[model samples]
Target: MSGKSSWPELVGVMATAAATQIGHDRPDVAVEVLPPGAPLTPDYNDHRVRVFINLSAVVIQTPVIG
Candidate 1:
């Protein structure tokens, strides 16, 4: 799935988790492999080049404070 979301943080966190599950095991190495001080989160449309993981999003909203 090609995932994009209004919540880039959610995407980033999930991406980080996915990486960790697969043994990348470091947040920095998970998101971007280019160098230090790269973007803290991937773009909404960005799937990792090496891994070819497509993250097509399906958002369902619920009130957080309801």
Candidate 2:
């Protein structure tokens, strides 16, 4: 959990793989796979990483710890 805080390379990866990779890197945080434009609270969390995906279940944005 002391490595990268963001995964820009995972943008085009599959959601499941992205989640698994993120989880392995930051087991202390929660990884949430969500579709783009999904409703999300404005509050930022240090223990959370949101993986935004497209309709094909492919990550559309860089997964980052907020």
Which portions of model 2 miss their true places by more than 4 Å?
Answer: none
Relative to the true structure, candidate 1 reaches a TM of 0.20
C-alpha lDDT values of all predictions: 0.28, 0.91
Indicate which candidate wins on lDDT.
2
**Each prediction's number of clashing residue pairs:** 6, 1
How would you encode candidate 1's per-residue C-alpha lDDT over 1-66 as one tens digit per residue? 332212322333334443343333222222322222334343442333222223432112210100
Minimal lDDT window, size 10, model 1: 57-66
Candidate 2 per-residue lDDT, tens place, 1-66, comes to 477799999999999999999998889999989986789999999999999999999999889998
Against the true structure, what is each candidate's TM-score?
0.20, 0.92
lDDT at 22, model 2: 93
| TM-score between candidate 2 and the true structure | 0.92
